[model samples]
Target: MSDAFFSEVTGRIPYAGLDSTDPLAFKVYQPDRLVLGKRMEDHLRVAVCLWHSFNWPGSDVFGVGTFDRPWLDARLDPLVAARAKLDAAFEFLAKLGVPYFCFHDRDVAPEGKTWADTQRTLETVIDQIAGRMEQTGVRLLWGTANLFSHPRYAAGAATNPDPEVVAVAAAQVRSMLDATKRLGGENYVLWGGREGYETLLNTDLAQEETQHARFLAMVAEHKHRIGFKGMLLIEPKPQEPTKHQYDYDVATVRGFLERHDLAGEFRLNLEANHATLAGHSFHHEVAAAIAAGLFGSIDANRGDYQNGWDTDQFPNSVDELALALYEIVRSGGFGSGGFNLDTKLRRQSLDRTDLFHAHIGAIDTLARSLLVAAALIEDGELERLRAERYVGWSGDLGRSILKGDAALELLSVRVLSGDIDPRPVSGRQEMLENVVNRAIWSVDRAELAAIGTPVGAAGRG
Candidate 1:
């Protein structure tokens, strides 16, 4: 576990402040620095994802693998390679000082020839991972079942027309759910990769919807039966492998949960790239989820603006994430959820140090964004303006209308009789944007360091 594979990165990454020249040091992410009355690490419960960091072979559909990972080499025995991968993964996690990690069932273990063999392999790997967690104090943020990669789920998992395929999906989910409980994961996530129709010609919309709802209900029941104390999360994406997905966005998932009577059991795991794909901003999706009280977790990645696909690149721009973090702050911050780095290294970034570089930059982006969000909240002008804009809602007429005390005839008579001439006013959108800009620019490393941190804590190391 002591830097088993990543030989170059020695010891844990330290907070070297904003002026540090060292690439391996954390510039803005000081875990112990106080933000909004709590330690920075407690506010941003960041996690490293196993799938993209370890399992992905740096190969796209058009090319061969380019990474220098011998553990992913197929010539070696699967079990031995898996063990090696686990060792390296733990080393990276410990050195990075991340509190939690996430994984898919397939990401942790290679699939075997038979179902029983796969299960056993997964169990062995899970045991190894548990031991590593105990040694390093790194916890599982969540665990998921990869329902789309295999041929058995080509059509769909629960929404498949074949009952046997649906049963297979159920079995996989059950096994992974049990593994999550065994690992003491904080949440369980469901990513419906192909749980939607490609074409209407052969799709029975009503039947598929019913089947999906039933499958979710069964999973919820199993979670309770097993006594797993974790939040149930579902991710939303507009489309990728399929033409459309049921969980397209926060609003769509909210309606689906309401229709299935499963609103109380699941929450939304928002992703920045997925939000962009769904024709919305990350801020818009976070706001939507917060409004519906379904905000649970986030997958920290950004999509390419030039292209229309999920790029899954590490976040770099604070401006892109500030408003979204603002929404998270307004909603009282994450409860059982955290920011999991669901990102990939560029194909050309094959050097071992690039992994640390990617994560370090993304973590700093979120850290700076938290500062901007806190400043906005403390400023009071933004919220005050919002409240003033809606001040009329607190009036007697507004209350009566909402209470159903004013009928259409009564309202029309009042409007006609009373000289109630209403006119539209400016929303001051530009002014508000300027205020946010001010908050972003006004945040200073010196000021932040002065609050609850040792002198020169923010200085160059």
Candidate 2:
């Protein structure tokens, strides 16, 4: 399809239109055409999460504040700067060939007014950015509601102990859903990082879980009645501020949605860092969600167990990403969804755009990984060699051979002779090495230097 038509239909450009040498009005940027399958816009949109948008020291007040005053002031300048950043980011994304974005509520309304007034501001911002998004061929994956924003819910929001607090949380969700619909969002996501408890004392698990389910059901019903077309994405995080969270993993969320009859309309936006935090491979989580037919979205990032919760680092590990790429490549390449860089910047980085380069580098690495994996799989001998290397030595065959010709044959060197060649398998590994090694050799370093790279660059613009 034409890029414009594709953009209109999916609210994004198709994978093919990502690279245009026909020169637009923005900086000259072109992502390496590595992953030969499709463009980020056409294949599946890549989004930047707004969790790290503010670039402020005191912005976490939305999560830990007693009052919203200080947080509001920090938001103003960052957002004004962010709008410009958004333009640049879109230009960068367009050049990278990825399209579509998932916006957090705070990206637009970072404590400028009352909760109600902030909601209105969100609506206005969406309207304002809609044109620019169209120009850049980016579409909305959805909008997020900051459920962990208020201190009134030190316990939780929808799952709070207080009935009044739960009511307010639901009300905000309803409004946010409306805002999503108004902006032509494709889906809405909820990440209940604060829904679980650090202590069992005075905690009513049944009541809280039930209330949370009821809140989701109500939101679904309300949106259904209004004929809202967007789906809902429920992301799972193990724990952070609280010792345990309600939607701790995909299985937990799957069970909750099933019990609440939200399994169909609500799907999982599985974040890689969350999976790593939960002690599972990120690719395994993606595969699990896909197997359950609930793989709706992705929050792409990495984490380290040695650190605190929500580390939000880039997925730069090669082997981990190779496995992930293999899983998705074999599954037809992220069928109908997108990847959102759910990353953040620490107090360390002074430059904002450095975060952008880091994200770009991470994505480029993954793209290369995917390409190498697909090549290995299609090479015709790697899979058979791997199977022979593994399955022949273990399982029932190893135990069943007692003491006859069979046992003698098992010990026989002839049995291990040549079901698969080790040479080709070595070549596959070497091929992967070459693919990764050549990633940088293909880069035009001189061109990058000409761009006048900025400093203190942080945040995935």
Find the candidate with the highest lDDT and give its number.
Answer: 1
TM-score per candidate, in order?
0.97, 0.70
lDDT of 1 by residue, 300-320 (tens): 999999999888999998998
Error of 1 at 429 (Å): 0.6
lDDT of 2 by residue, 1-461 (tens): 12321132222222222122322211222333334445433443567664463323323534442221222343457455446445544554554455566666666555545776666666666666676677776677778777785787788988888889888778777877877787678888888867999799979899988999998888888889778887788889899877998888888888888887889778888888889788888878887887787888777778876975677777676566666656666667664456677776544553444444555556655554554555555653545655766664465554455323355655565457864234433436775556544543333232233344333331225
Locate the minimum summed-lDDT window of 10 residues in model 2.
Answer: 17-26
Q: Which residue segments of model 2 deviate by more than 4 Å? A: 1-37, 54-97, 111-115, 380-461
lDDT of each: 0.92, 0.64
In model 1, what is the error at residue 26, expressed in angstroms?
A: 0.5
lDDT against true structure, model 2: 0.64
lDDT of 1 at 104: 96
Poorly placed runs, candidate 1 (over 4 Å): 445-461
Instruction: Name the best candidate (by TM-score).
Output: 1
